[model samples]
Target: MITSRLMVLRRAVCVSWLSSCVRKQNYCSSAKKTRVREALTSLDSGSSIRIQGWVRSVRLQKNNLFLHVSDGSSLHPLQVVASSDLNTRGLTFGCAVDITGSLEKSPSHKQRVELQAQKIEVVGECNPVDFPFKIKGHHSLEYIRQFPHLRCRTNVFSSLLRIRSEATAAIHNFFRDNDFVQIHTPVITSNDCEGAGELFQVEPAGNEHSLDEENPHFFSVPSYLTVSGQLHLEVMAGAFPAVYTFGPTFRAENSQSRRHLAEFYMVEAEISFIQSLEELMKVMEELFKASTEHLLSHCAEDVELFHKYNSPAHREQVNLMLKRSFNVISYTEAIEILNHSSEQFTFKPEWGCDLQTEHEKFLVKHCGNVPVFVTDYPYDLKPFYARDNEDQPRHTAAAVDLLVPSVGELCGGSLREERLELLKTRLARTGLDSTYAWYLQLREFGSVPHGGFGMGFERYLQCVLGVDNIKDTIPFARFSHSCPL
Candidate 1:
């Protein structure tokens, strides 16, 4: 009797071991399936595939389920159909899941393809009660702004971000193909590039209270966040002939507008051995075209979304923009056009004054709505670094502002003043100290006529994606009075 009992116990143990081995094999096989994109392209309809992604939306039916999953590549969602026994009781929105299924072309007219899921495993769970995006209604921008961490999971935000990444890559590829060496410029500097007095002051460690004490401050010299990388790139251009810097730049202005940001990304390029301002304009045109064409070709889904949901006028404008060559108008001509216009502007266009946002919009909207390079601004209105045109009026400089539809001032460039004496005189007249001795030394030693401009990365993203707010262009935005997650 004892021997028979021992035999029964051993057999039961062997059965349990076999069951565990089978379960392990099943898990390993599921892990080795192809990605969603690959599965969709393959001609085999019954091929086994597995995909893992965050749950975008979940529709629960009495006998089955429908889920939209996004793995963060394209804007299109992967449709997943699950059976009733998938154990989805604890699953909620934004939950991560692994699904093993057969890839099938869509039978319904709406979907392109569908995944008939055989097994669904819950990789992670999200609590619906605590989640901010659980409701099935459109959330206001202000309310959605509170959840920056989870906001990217939304359809609109995700689409905008995908376009932003594509546009940035396109910009870099354009510079690389044109023999421009990428340079890293300093973020903290003593000199102001824009000369606009809108820089954010950077306080040194242990000197936080020095300003209050009023003893000339025990600080290691005050430094401020750089508003532009133009000066630094100019110095580099003298050595490298052609170079560009793409990085973060900060401004301290408190204006609350759709176009302004406290901190933003800038792309500054300076090229030496350039003959005239026309060459600079050509480079700007090529950069704009390259970036726009890249996004339009590669990001079809995102572009479609922009056309559908964004302003109706925007689609027509974008189509018209790419159809023809951009127009070139001098600052004087732009003033004339604006002055003659039947539409009234708040700040009327004048020859000596800077182009306000309203004037830029009018020029783009009426004048073919294509990118325009408005050149020859009043030197006094521009930075001290811009090269003054000897042939033009007294304060006029050889500067150009690249204006696009819905995005004003995409790029700003000029022929830099390379003469040492003239630069020094301009700096002194502008009341800026000659503290940057090295920068001035470049002009003194072996300077050539060099010119460059800074393009805001977020601004380019806004134009490419047709997004209105600059805050949504970046993953983690730091704007005035707003920094959520």
Candidate 2:
């Protein structure tokens, strides 16, 4: 009987040990939890929750300590309140911390709810002196640009990231909804799409000296970082009725203007069986309107931050852009408007010359600061692939450029030269017939009159946000004589 009692005691001890282990495991699992965004939205009062994020601000009061924490989910940070009795060690601006707290109604009007902390654990410590962002009132976009690595921690850059992500999603959705297949185009190519002589040559590693030797270069013939994806989209359009590509493009031009970037993104779309420039312009207009609408609806708060801090004029521009349809005018009419303008232009408006930024800005203003599509540019000003208009007085191409306020040209597109004879003749004149034989084959097999356009992604952001520089729109700014990480 005594031995039986002892066995029962041992079994009871084993059960207790197992229960203890389970409790510890549960505690450990629940410790590293809760996003600041979710914590801010909690409606259950007096519920214990754990939140983790980088501390945006810390305010110590006589009885309580308040911290503004953010996990990048929203533009605004969550308010975390801890009692003076709680350990506040290692909690500072930019320091990552995990706090176990209770949900409570906020006394202040800034936020709906705040965290009443019972425990605070420092996940990572940051030195306030070494941190570049010291929680200032308002930082200029130019000043924050100096610290690319840590700029995302700020409110403005973080908002831009959110806007960019939403805009990308909206672009994909617009294409998908309209039955346009997203095609991945090759970044390296043998022919320059623009034929501008601004190609960045790509050579094989350890063979830098053999560029001119002609001893089996990296690609047999020379290859370059693609300046545009229009040709590839053109190729795909032949197969698929509608195709588009959004990817990085490179240029070797030494332009240092606010609107220029050596490496940037382009959104190109090609539609087969297109008859006139009107059809292509319709697609471009719909795309711009749809994407901008999506951004304004979804990222209203984040986009407003750009207007409030960056440029107050941006608010009116955005409202106008949304309220009205884009304006359309012929290239000839645009030039005439510029020529008739009272304001003196640095580059005089001429018949055959390319429209400079000054001219584009003037045209946009003349149209009451609305986005304008100027169609039928001079044939000589466009590339060899642009379809010839074959007009009476002036030779022009079936090309169009979308110009916006603040930014000169946001998009450029043309109806492709699909006639085999016309394409061959143009290529022969440009001396690119042999190099672009494959392009000719597409016309030979199944020729359909098609057109496409390329929109500079950075310039689009600048136009929508009224940002002054193209660099501020992109995550990493790359330009002439400047490449910073």
Candidate 3:
């Protein structure tokens, strides 16, 4: 009887312990199932949602906490309200967090929505003392430039970047739809495409030497960063009827103006057997219109901000640009117009003189906000590769520069000199090496009438966004005095 009682008591104790273990396992499983909710830009009233983003700002009241969070999508902030038990302590600006809440339409403002938080999860921490950005006031461009990595988090910079991205996509789509083959050109080039002596030299490893070195340094071959990809695109155009190259180009020019950059992007296109400069101008007009219209359709918020802050003249300019047809004029006519204009230019307009930025701006702004292509430049003023007009005086070349208001000389193009003999004569005149035997071979093999143009990508962005500087258009700007993270 005693043994039976002991066995029964032991069995009962074992069963009780097993039941407790099972209960604990169930509790753990339920806790592990808890997860963050999906993110929605705008939530309907009386609907529960969860959001995750960096905390932009925070306010603490006696019994509640108000937090503004940004998820890097829109310019506006999402207002989050949390109760006192949500552990608001150690919550600093810029820290990432996840919040579960019921969204409600703002009683005071119809445009705004509020989230009342039921739970809060801190994903990351930020030190307020060391944080570079603040929620109180705006920072100057010069100050924000110091922190390039962090500046993109701001409203203005974010808007500019979004627009830049949309513009790039629009350009690619335009070219793709027009049957233009996208070509990638080499960056480290041995040839000078732009003949404008503004090239950044690259030396071989261990080739550094003093200027007074008696003998040429070992492994020192003259190399340079390409100023343009026009020549390379021509080679591709020979294979493909229509081709374009969009990539980075570098220049060593010591320009201190808002227009120039040490390194910038260029969009270059070359076509084979093109009919006339008129056709080329048509392409330019269509491309600009397509790019602008695409951006306006997609980037509404960015366009609104751009018009509000940077260019109050955006609506009028865009309307004028869309309605007005491009005006075709010769270099001589451009000079005449500049000389007749009331605005006195720094460099007085003269024949054979390259159009100054001031001269080009006046022609575009006053002559109607349409692109003007000034063609048939004086032979001596153009590069050796440009086709010279036989009928015109001074051996003028068939070159064109598309100028627009605010952004002068947006593009430059010319019909290539196809005649081998004439090209050789022009090359000799310009002092280029005849040793470019491979390039000459293209003409020898059967070169046809071809023309191409190069548009400054940053300049286009500047015009579209109405941003003041080229540095802001690019993510990492390389300038004279500054190169920062």
My TM-score estimates for the predictions, one after another, are 0.85, 0.89, 0.84
| Higher-scoring candidate on lDDT, 1 or 2 | 2
Best by TM-score: 2
Model 3: per-residue Cα lDDT over 39-72, one tens digit each: 1222246566566678889898999898877665
On lDDT, the candidate that comes out on top is 2
The C-alpha RMSD of each candidate to the native structure, in angstroms, is 9.9, 9.9, 13.0
lDDT of 3: 0.75
- Candidate-wise lDDT, in order: 0.74, 0.82, 0.75
Give the true-structure RMSD of model 2.
9.9
Mark the regions of model 3 whose C-alpha exceeds 4 Å error after superposition.
Answer: 1-50, 100-114, 129-132, 140-143, 204-220
- Candidate 1: list runs displaced more than 4 Å: 1-40, 43-46, 104-106, 109-113, 134-136, 139-143, 204-219
- Number of backbone collisions per candidate: 1, 0, 0
Q: Using lDDT as the measure, what is the rank order of every candidate, best first?
A: 2, 3, 1
Per-residue error at 246 for model 1, in Å?
Answer: 1.3
Q: Please give, for residues 1-485, the per-residue lDDT of candidate 1 as tens digits.
A: 00000000011111001111112223221221123222224335665656667787889899879887766655656778888887776567888887778767666665656778887877889887788886376754455667788887777677777787778788899999999999988988877777778887876566555555444433456778888878888877877989998889998877778788888899889999886889988888788878888888877677777667664456677766677787888888888899889987899777788899999989987777788888888878787778878886555888999898897878888998887888888777766645766767887778888888878888877776677877767878787787565
Which candidate do you rate higher for TM-score, 1 or 2? Answer: 2
| Number of clashes found in candidate 1 | 1
